[model samples]
Target: MNTSELDLRELLSFKPRGGAISFLGQRMYLTDLFSHGLQQMELCRTLGPEITQSIIVRAGFSKGWLVAERIKRQMPDAWAEARKGKLGPLLCSMYGFGEVLSSQRRDGIQATPLVETYFISLYEAEQHLRMHGLSNVPVCWEQIGFASGYVSNLEGRTVYFIEDECQAKGDSYCHLRGNYLEKWGAEITPYLPVYSGICNETVAAQLADVLRSDEALPRNMQDKINLSLKLTSIEDGYPVSNSYAMRSLLEMAINVAKVPTSVLITGESGVGKEKLVQYIHKNSPRSDKPLVAINCGALNETLLENELFGHVRGAFTGADCSKSGLIEAADGGTLFLDEVAELSPATQVKLLRVLQEKEVRRLGDTETNHVDVRIISATNKSLEAAVEAGEFRQDLYYRLKVIELNIPPLRERTEDILPLSRYFLMKFNQELGKNHTGFHYKTADLLLSHNWPGNVRELVNAIERAVVLSAGPQIMPEDLPHEIRDTLCLPSVAGDIRALHEVEKDYILAVLEKLDNNKTQAAEKLGMSLATLYRKLKEYGALQIAICSWLYSIAAILPGV
Candidate 1:
């Protein structure tokens, strides 16, 4: 029976496991993503297959119904991705947040009093999820995109299409053996309500079309990328991916608290090199004493020395009062020199004397003062290169590199993007009193795809900008600044083509594997012309392998198949 054109009121015989649940007027579901076969494998396979489930769940995104508003209002505390698309059972492991809605019926009549999206509470959402007793997608972002999508409004509608496809799977065999595809199962989820009433099918479809449009490129350009930013561990509330490394470095600094060795922290300009310096000071034994910090690159020789060491009365023109330098203030504590590489020769000599003699002679004074202080310096440049080029002193370079730590760029730690994104979201929301729940799923992908040249600093600035600009419960793609907007559309900027190709390849392979080698779906997702995809597949000789892999996987995961 062709149910597509019939009014839902005429035939209400459909029965999916978790009957249609909705929030407001948006329609969506909670799919039993894990068929009986996969459950058996997960229970039985040890290292046998950790990647399979992640792959299966990821296939949910290929056909999702994403609605930008309701998903945001319903799960204000959820990840941004969820707000835009209605995905399958959210893989919390890598779940970015979202809600699902589906139409429900109690009688034989298929027509509803009216199609509606239903509001669900946080507690109820939690309870409903708990009762399912199913695992979420893998924690990794790559895995989440594969395991299951954070489906929302339009994304949910797409999934219904997928459901249609899945139910139709056996139809092909019907021609040969007269066997029909069985209705495996189905489900429904809740949606959030908006003041302007529910999003109609037409508008929802239009929105989806826009989201998939290439014009979204203003947010994806490469040249406009900033190159400085620290990989911050915590800002608003989200934890960055390299939290472990940053923490380990802090612990190392603490371990050497008693030693007076100079510590050099190298990273991009805005990568929080200075912040890490502070972390070292706070963790060191000199925590009780004053800690002074100066940017060596920001001042001239005479001013720099006077800034680091005290000046005698009438020593210089601005010697209005005999004043103590930052060094004097941090007596018995620690002195942090930022951009230490920028220090001129004259300033370098004075700093070297302070470190070596543990004494300082105030300007124009014959007498010298003895002091004890630890020195912690930071620089974003390559000190070794500077030393070789005769720009920085050999002695100072030797001293600083004694204990060096290098901070990895954000692109190097893609796993952390979502976590840090959320951290910023929660923080800005609380600080500004906005009720933004999180990003749209596409936003998460956008962040991952971006080349954060400015590092951790850039993320903070972007989040702050987005927070101030947004007035709604969710941060839409438009909420992001032009830089991030361009990032999603442009090709990878931070890395070379090789890396980009690898990432793209992995994404395609993972999706294909998840869809059980469904060529049509895979082709749609590869964002390629079918001929191009087929030619490339033929060139790589991946066509046969992909099909074989998919069949084997399905045979292994499906029960009694």
Candidate 2:
């Protein structure tokens, strides 16, 4: 696998049979080109560019480490001495990061390669063209982090790569600078925010100092609720879910957990569908056994088949050793397939067989093995819609949906938002050693009012960011992420230019009518007391009927009218 022996064709080639591309023992799946860009755009708009960049950089850094490890194992001698300079071009080719026109060692440090076709640069350039200057920085944090991570492991030192210029920032060509961190000292401090999970020690210390000046207050009601819910949340590894809808869902999950039926958990991404699956797994009879989870969407069909069902040593190219699949690992437990809707039709047919027979046949294996395992699959997409479109198998959909649980989105469960926020705030405060008590009133109002498109995941990220940035005891609106803070705190019906009293009357009447004039049910839905509902109804001249109905119920119960 050394540079001289590396076959470029073997490194990256499309498989005619599977329509999948192989890269470094991994499968490359394809999607709409603009889909990823659009997602990044939305993340930046919601979490702000800096936070999103940090997230992307962290992801790239992890990926780079994995690739570095793979290359080292495959080419031990080539990795031992860094002279080959072939790994960069190989990675660039595989990842569409551009060609390394030239790379050299300089003063015992590796020089940043002159990339001729930087993928991220072109992506950002097109994004800016479409958005007309939506980005302000290099917009290449992931690429920079990837280069730094790969080189740092290869060189056996802490290396850093900085995007010195980017086409997104109006530069003609995206250029980068690289060196060991010790060689650059504070020179690279400006780029720290783009890197994820690296807190500046000085800033954290300053925050700790400020916290010491604040009073150690007793736990209030909200604090108590947060503390209790946070403890349970941590215990179960679930997010804070205190709303009626979530509670009912949990109750149903608990009841269904007693059975060995296949379960399908559906929700938008980041609503913690996996967490609910875990909750069910823990409460089930198979709690003591392994709970294996695989993301069907992350792997292409070839790799996915090899992973889920495993293979013999001669299964395919690079299958040097016999491997057991996740199904075997979860023989007596549960297997959760995240993004199960993304399973290729071929894989779906094979999975359907497993569900029907409770047995798995490994690739290139002559025999099938019986396994006792529960299947709990989750997906963000509508599996029914996919099935209707013939993208997903109808039988598999019905098999997985024997017991379905649709977790409500965060907007519908607004009561949980504040508790969840405070829980995350407290959780991060402990992690960061901050004494932040709670959100400011305005900040709380903003959180309550804004629609969290990303749901609990987004809220958690916002709290973590606020925790990291807050310099005071309270998290102010300024400390929140821009999307939340920038929201206009107008009335709910901002477009309806009606008087406040009239609006209230209309809303109350609508609720009562929706409930068939059942004042108790209307009061419960409105989050008000029966007396309050009666008073509002009386003021609106709609109480007499409700009063007569109540009297009629009492008279009937007493056998007198």
Index of the highest-TM-score prediction: 1
Worst lDDT 10-window in candidate 1: 172-181
So what's the TM-score on candidate 1?
A: 0.52
- The digit string of per-residue lDDT tens for model 2 on 1-561 reads 234334333244343334454455444666543777788889989999778888877666656655675565333434444434556656755576654445554554333332223333445455555666744667776677777767666665656677766778777666666676666667678876666433223223433333222212211211100112232462355566767799889889989989889999999988989889999999899999999999998999999998899998887888889899999999999999999999998999989989999999999888899989899999989999998998999999999999999988998887787778877887887888876666654466578668999998999899999989976555767788889876644334322244677546656765664465787898998899999988887786556645555555577679545
The C-alpha local distance difference test score for the whole of candidate 2 amounts to 0.70
Q: What is the TM-score of each candidate against the true structure?
A: 0.52, 0.48
Per-candidate local distance difference test: 0.51, 0.70
RMSD (CA, angstroms), candidate 2: 28.4
Model 1: lDDT of residue 480: 86
In angstroms, how far off is 361's CA in candidate 1?
Answer: 1.4
Candidate 1 residue lDDT tens string, 113-214: 111222222221233234443233111122222212222242332211111111012221101000001211222221111001222354355554444332
RMSD to the hidden true structure, all candidates: 18.8, 28.4
